[model samples]
Target: MSSFPQIPQTIADEQQLDDWLTTPSSELIEFVRTLSGDLLVLGAGGKMGPSLAVRAKRAIDAAGSPASVIAVSRFSDTTSRQWLDDRGVVTHAADLLDRNAVEAIPDAANVLYMVGTKFGTSQNPAFTWAINTVASSQVMQRFAGSRFVALSTGNVYPFVPVASGGATEDGPIGPVGEYANAALGRERVFQYFSTCNGTPVTLMRLNYAVDLRYGVLTDIGLRVFSGEPVDLRNGYLNCIWQGDANDAIIRALGTAESPHCLLNLTGQETLSVRAIANEFARLLERPVQFTGEETESALLSNSAKCCDLLGAPQISTETMIRWTADWLRQKGRLLNKPTHFEVRDGKF
Candidate 1:
């Protein structure tokens, strides 16, 4: 495996962060070289979408492909749209929930479906279902012939024993909460379309994608730094670097199937949140607080299949923890988005 690249301790601004996140690996470039046709990334304004879109552009350029990376999103923030626009990624602003707007998007051979809602599911599950299931139905109908990679959540899997090495791709999906159930419904929608229309689709079950700005590591690091007690109920969890996740998503485009395929994507190890908190305490030179006892089972994923097929993640968890610590110490800009990984009931 290639050595993990060194992450700078202090990122000066968002552009620098974008550069770091979008820097393409040789493997990613090689993967893109095997592809032809422009790429369309739907719901490209989310946390992972911006960097993923930029990565696609960089990879296509590196592969010397004429494929343009077009990112379509509601684009509530013009800054994100401008960021993609400036980086050679075509940006389109549209409410994908609108059937007319969905029909208006230019068809592309390769499509990345990144739209879904998890937070506020309890208070507004109708909206969640609309975005996760209804919108996806329309999207599938609109792009029935295009190869698609849809981002699903690991929460769809029931809590499993910590020693089970996480849930495998073939594991039974027994989601515990409305959010997860709605996510499963989203998957079923695509599966239905894939089966009926012979549309090639790959469902990417991603748990957590970490960067310094906002993620499980950053969540714990901030809590430890603030001397707030870290909850240990959902002690064991998994995460992968956002960049590595992006690589896997793009690579999975090649694996899309008519009946749909499923791949669990996350880091290999089952991490202890308490242990991670202690590590962050050591890094921050602060005392750590603890609350709630560790549970035997937590939401986890087995990504061995993803590793075997799409290559192992390049960034190690230890490296990510250290980078996150350094980022927090240097007062790096955070997107203020929390993972809510600590929640045991899956309320968020």
Candidate 2:
């Protein structure tokens, strides 16, 4: 009997929610079995949190005992709370930044630190560092003996490769923009976890997560179908479907028993920005035109490690693009969607 709350059939329904669920896999089931106690998912209101929480419930159900799932989130509304309650997941709405607040989290034997911050506002650094870094450190310290699966981004790897391209887990973190510190926050948190043998930390360095709400595929589709101009850049990009991303992370947690493990999460194929734009144009029947000079991206990570560690994702990039386009057409967001989200120097 499956106790996992079923994820909605469509992205619109899920995103509107207080919460959503990721597709569960066999490997994920195995990982949940290894856990000795309840699985706590930090930042459970975010994109993948709901799914992870539900998956935990399913795992517990499979084990024939109700494993506790504590989902910590400040943004989750009543609907989100109800979803967790329906699935028997304990939901907590508290700021992780305060050490006192973080201390409130029951000491979980296994913790998935799924917290993150992007799109920083003017006064966001305090909250960013607090939630992204300090809170994680506090949580790690709180659950000293618990194993932690912390999320990292491929953004840590330098883009376009200055000396050489295709960054490995060892690649120097060369993130750009005012958001650079935000990128480093993951490293700092897990580094704290790495110190104690109690909390073995596994960092998942993810590339672009392909989702309809945001990411490369949707951005390109919006531009092409909306008849907008393409913004070209000089860089090789790697992406994985959001579902695949969830698979990879679940695998990481399942396999990780030692600390200081860092795996890069991305698709095997690398394509230029223009190449992807052209593909979208072909799909949308629009001309792929660019109005900007090719600027270099500072970070591009290699996913060979993840491929070898966790099985390679079965979904192809071509399929990802088609799904994203179809999703947009369904949402009716194609016409006015901006091609490239970022516009630099008066050009796309």
Q: What TM-score would each prediction reach against the true structure?
A: 0.97, 0.83
Q: What value of lDDT does candidate 1 attain over all alpha carbons? A: 0.90
lDDT by residue for model 2 over 1-348, one digit each (tens)?
112234334445334422333445666676667768877888888766776787667657765655788888885467777777787788888788777888887767778878877554235666665666777777777887877778876655545552344688875676554345565776776775676554577888877776566677777667777777766654356778766676566557655554578888788776676777788787667777675666555346778877887777766687777766657667633323322334321121
Flag clash pairs in model 1: none
| CA displacement after TM-score superposition, residue 339 of candidate 1 (Å) | 1.0
Give me the runs in candidate 1 sitting further than 4 Å from their true place: 1-13
Tens-digit per-residue lDDT, 233-346, candidate 1: 889899998988988898899889989999998999999999999999999999999999998999999999989888888888998898888888888888889999989787
* 296: Cα error in model 2, Å: 5.9
Residue-level error in angstroms, candidate 2, position 110: 1.0
- Candidate 1 structure, TM-score to reference: 0.97
Taken over the whole model, the C-alpha lDDT of each candidate is 0.90, 0.67
How many clashes show up in model 2? 6
C-alpha lDDT of residue 40 in model 2: 83
